[model samples]
Target: MLFRQLEYFVALARERHFARAAAACYVSQPALSEAIRKLEHELGVPLVRRGRTFEGLTPEGERLVLWARRILADRDALEHEVRALRTGLTGELRIGVIPAASATVTQLTDPFCTEHPLVRIRVETSLRSRDIVDRIRRFELDAGIIYADGVDTDGLTSTPLYQERHVLVAGSELLAGSTAAISWAEALDLRMCLLPKGMRGRQLIDDALATRGLVAAPQLESDSVATLLEHARTGRWACIVPRPWVSTLGPTAEVRVFDLVDPVVTAHIALVTTAAEPASVLTTALTGTARETDFATVDRRQR
Candidate 1:
């Protein structure tokens, strides 16, 4: 019934582990468990299932969690609006950025902080694009930097910040040290490490490769771009990465971005927010700046 309880419930649902959820909410485990119990009693339905640890949500709990996000989002919006009137636009903005495009997350933040010095900005890097979309939908994220059209985004709106082209990168040994653009089929013949199969970006890569009637043999796989980049740096393997992201490695990190052949895959990177919710001023400004900002300038700083 209380907004605080809803926030707590949402956190527990996300963290799944009561102890960790309590830590995240800065409360003790018992207090969180008691609050959730009281909330269930008041609602006349359990919001979480019992187990040795948090196993999963029940059907009803899952449904309520969705509704809770909307209610809590509305409540937070009211508080943000009131505070904006009291002061200039100010509040915390949480954003999620996918790994490939994660470097661009700060582009919108610098200008935002300069203009609204009182605002706080928080960003979490997610390798999976769907995770970014899910967090944005749950109101856990104010906005996200994700692929332009990768997500269904039926209930959300986004503005393209830039177009990202895919690169088939290999070590000098793979391309004989010099650079050679590899076809999807040719790339498949080499050792490759890609984002985990479950990741949305991975799915995009798969679908693109499927068009060539080729499925890559991935001997090493990870959901972390940092790991993928690290492996590629050793020149022992190759990876498919987004363009512009290539320069993020250290100077010793020798790598090259090669254009894909025949069917080149390109996706627009966009700043996205839920259209169904009222956005905080910080969220609005971040979204606005992302679409208008010069990423070339910002990306240099990220490097």
Candidate 2:
């Protein structure tokens, strides 16, 4: 019945291993098991399928996990509200961002930090668009930045932040003085290092090329933008990247950027947050900043 027990159960459910869950909860295996046992006794229902090793949660445990997450989230929100009244916004804001939107995350984070200097910001860029939505639903993230297309937005509020314009990036040596835009068909003819097929950005590229009666066969596939950009920097391969990524690259002396033409495919990037009643204060601030961010102005300034 204790809050710690609920936390322990939630950790156990997520980790799916008694030892690992205990480690995550900063407790010993025996202590965690005892706590779960006490929780089950108090609730009068077996939450887990007990065995020598970690077994999946029981049907009841599945339901309890949802309730546990909401309870913990509500408790944190209450604390944040009280602290805000006394000390301004103070707490951690966890954001899950798709790699394509990685560079533009600062648009929201920077403003949020400036307004609420006490809040800590954490941006995780290793998630897919779907994974970002899933985390928001689970209350594991305050908000996320992801592509607006084909994402599950149920129970979430989405605000369009900017349009992602595709661009071709290559080593300056490879491109020489050629700065003209290239068609998708022309770009595919080069030795390309691109994001893997599993990523949404890669999928969009493939679909666009498919419409042009072409298939992308990348010379190298990577999930990391840095990795692809590094390959392009070697002067052996060209990569397609989003315009927002230019800001993150700092100085692009090694690579020349060209806008992609001949069927320009621009996708909208949105700030997504849970639409749960009484949204978290952090999510509110983030979405507000997203709404106010003038991407056109930011792009002009950055240029």
Candidate 3:
């Protein structure tokens, strides 16, 4: 019933441990337990399936946790709005970013911070597109930078941020005789280090190769784009990455960057936020920032 009780319950659901949840809430174990008990009594439902150790939430608790998250999110948004009306935006804006788009997130965050100096920004850069979308839906992230293609956007608002074109990067020795552009099949033939199949970038690459009846059998697979690039730098493997990343994280020496051709693949990168009505103030501000951001400079440089 009380907001504090809801906080404790949500924390418990998240931590899945009574002691850790109590620690997170900065309250004693007994206090947290008593609050949840009171909340359960008020709702007339057994929220937790308990034993000596922490058991999982009951069915009713599982459903109510979703509502509890929404309520807490709404409460924070209300506080942010009221505080902003008097003192400018002053809360943290939590953003989840897909790793392929990690280098480019600063394009939005830098300006957002400059405009609202009091607002704090937290960027989680290692998420996949699906993970970012899931977190946004769960009210865990205010916005996300993710690949726009092949992701379920139902109940979400997406603003196109930029187009990402894949490029092949490898040590000079590995690409000693390669041309300015290489076909997907040729790239696949090299000793390659590629993102795992679960990543959106990898999926796009796989789809492109599938058109040629070819599959990427990389020498190594990693979830991190940086890791793939690192392996490429060793002269033993080649990796494919977004062309824009070449300007930022691409190696300056010992590497040859080739445009991926013979069916060049491009994916739309987008900023996504939940489609909930009465959008949070931070989400509105971030959406506006996304609209006004000038990616032309980066685009031109990448060209």
Candidate 4:
């Protein structure tokens, strides 16, 4: 059968309703049903249980669904490679990244564009890890930069890009009267600004603070770290942010980042791509730049 038939099968298998499946396939229900019937006849297998409504796929149908996903993915990859041969590194690379790691993507994108100028780059920022992986698998996004821990990447491959280092940032007023490091107990009293609870970074923060049986009282929550830093600079605010981002501050004359004492926390971020297909040339180069990026925090520590 053709790729369109397999596409129709996967859409039907997922929705289990003719109307919904057809809508997802961007066709009329009658059109989708005919295609499925054609596919079953060609394969000589009963693929779906039919009546007035779509019931479910048979055992053989379920197995074909799995194979269909693989075949479709490979088919798309082959088409992209062929197009690249004629066009030279042209197509689209859709990248999803954790909202906290959004800023770092700029570093990779610039160099990547230089290498594959013909490719179009799209970036989406999301706070959830599962959502990132889901988007990557469903063909919504070509790749994602996300936390590697506790994310199920069943058919995805990852290369560790950097270790996101954590640090304590506070209003200059708080730091002026205190030591170089801020202990957890001492930080409990300050007005904290953290990423919304949806982010994995916030979960890491909770994990770290749970040891002392203390949770932060966030007076403000934002997805953008730059905005959080601006709030700290302008108000009596304190935040625990990744150390690598400190360089973004033009000068921390009005703000101060202190070491979080006891056990310092770090999050490992990686570039993830679907394992089923060879990456398009643009995506491959983009992911490679991600792998080579120097999380500046590491170098500063080395010095």
**Local distance difference test, candidate 4:** 0.80
Mark the 10 consecutive residues where model 3 has the least summed lDDT.
244-253
Model 4 spans with C-alpha error above 4 angstroms: 11-26, 44-62, 134-140, 152-155, 174-176, 196-198, 219-234, 244-255, 276-283, 297-303
**Which residue pairs in candidate 1 have backbone atoms (N, alpha carbon, C) closer than 3 angstroms, thus clashing?**
172-177
Clashes of each: 1, 0, 0, 0
- For residues 84-129, write the lDDT of model 2, one tens digit per residue: 8898889999999999878777777888799889999999997998
Q: Which prediction has more favorable TM-score, 2 or 4?
A: 2
> What's the TM for model 3?
0.95
Q: Model 4, residue 201: displacement in angstroms?
A: 1.0
The number of the candidate with the highest lDDT is 3
Candidate 4 lDDT tens digits, 127-180: 477898987776667888889989898888887877776787888887688887
Q: List residue ranges in candidate 3 displaced over 4 A.
A: none
In terms of lDDT, which candidate is stronger, 2 or 3?
Answer: 3
Q: How do the residues 173-230 of candidate 3 rate in per-residue lDDT, one tens digit apiece?
A: 8768878998887787788888888778888899999999998888788888878877
C-alpha root-mean-square deviation, each candidate: 3.8, 1.6, 1.6, 4.0
Q: In angstroms, how far off is 176's CA in candidate 3?
A: 3.0
What lDDT score is found at residue 235 in candidate 2? 76
**Candidates' TM-scores?**
0.79, 0.95, 0.95, 0.76
Estimate candidate 1's alpha-carbon lDDT, on a 0 to 1 scale: 0.78
lDDT for residue 266 in candidate 3, whole number 0-100? 88
Residue-level lDDT for 113 in candidate 2: 91
